[model samples]
Target: MEFHHLGVATADASGLAALFAELFDAPVAHEEEFDGMTVLFLELEPGYFELLEPHEGGAISRYLENHGPGIHHVALQTDDIEGALETARGAGVELIDDEPRPGAWGHEVAFLHPKSTGGVLVEFVSH
Candidate 1:
């Protein structure tokens, strides 16, 4: 598996992404709107950071409402997401999405329940 990206839930993605852009002096690799959210992918040396701002109501917005802006999840790249999910299930880890779903950068993604991942939301992805 490879480190993919850190997805951060924030109220102001444009502002926060801009801050990160200045801090790293790196260009935003991609920006898109989907499922009531605006997302920015800021590329780093090895991976990227995904800034999520829910324009309407979605997971990120709900996260902000409940936890108030924080690291939402860490995405790890895998060769096969479904295989990875099955591996996790075999290990007795609960899953938020039992099946892979469409994700940022056109990858297949699944979330392992935070309860099973040391209280950090862990996402498995395969592009």
Candidate 2:
């Protein structure tokens, strides 16, 4: 597996994007909406940075409120998403999705609950 991206939950997407752009010289590569989340992709050296803002009342928004804005999840690039999910399950990790689904950047991904990952949400995405 390889490092894919870091997901940051923010209440203000444009503002955060601007901050990152100015601070790190990152540029917005793309933007999309998926699974009730508004996402913006910012290009970086190693991989990408993703800013996720809830489009409606949901878990991401709740996370923002309770956690107070920071790294929400870490994404790993995988050759097989199903295999990764199975591995996580065998290791007793709780999965947020029962099956791999469409994700940002034209990949299929699944999420493992933070409770299973030392309080860090982990996402596995098919490369």
Candidate 3:
């Protein structure tokens, strides 16, 4: 697996994207409205920064309520998502997603529970 992107929960994705563009020389690579949120992927050298702005009450909204705007999860790109999930399961990592599901950017994604992943949410994505 390789680093894919860092998911950030924000109330203003456009504002943050603009700021990151100027500060980090990152450009918006992709943008989409998915799962009730505005998702923007900013291009960086190695990977990307995925900005998530919730449109209504949902996981991101609830997350922002609990823990202001900040890093949410880290994603890793894999060739085989199912294999990765099985590896995680074999290691006893609790799965937040027992199976892959549709994610932003038309990728198959699954999440591992943060509690079992050193308190950091980890996502496995297959393009």
Candidate 4:
């Protein structure tokens, strides 16, 4: 697995995207609306910063309500998502999504429960 992207939950993706573009020289690589949120991927050196802004009352909205705007999850790239999920399961990690689902950038994604991942949400993404 390799570092893929850092997911950030915010109420203002455009604002943060501008700030990050100037601060980190990370221009927007992709932008789309997916799963009730505006998803923007800012290109970094080797990875991306995925900014998520919810347009409806869903997980991201709930996250903002409870935790405010901040880092949401860390994604790791994998060639075999099923194998990675199996590894996580074998390690006793709780799975939030037992099966991989469609995610931003049209990748397959599954998340491990934060409670089982040292309180930090971890995502496995296959592009």
Candidate 4 local distance difference test against the native = 0.96
Candidate 4 error regions (>4 Å): none
- Can you list the residue pairs that collide in candidate 2? none
CA lDDT, every prediction? 0.88, 0.88, 0.96, 0.96
9-123 per-residue lDDT for model 4 (tens digits): 9999999999999999999999999999999999998999999999999998999999999999999999998999999999999999998999988999999999998999999
Q: Which model is ahead, 1 or 4, in terms of TM-score?
A: 4
- Per-residue lDDT for 2-113 in model 2, tens only? 9989999998888999999999999998898877887998889877889998878788889888988889889999888888888888999999987999887688889999
Task: Write candidate 3's Cα lDDT for 1-127 as tens digits.
Answer: 7999999999999999999999999999999999999999999898999999999999899999999999999999998999999999999999999999999999999999999989999999986
In terms of lDDT, model 3 sits at 0.96
Q: Of the pair 1 and 4, which is ahead by lDDT?
A: 4
Per-residue lDDT tens digits for candidate 1, residues 11-124, read 888898889889987569899986788889988988889999888877787889899998999999998888999899999999999899998668888999999989989999
Off by over 4 Å in 2: none
TM-score of 1: 0.95
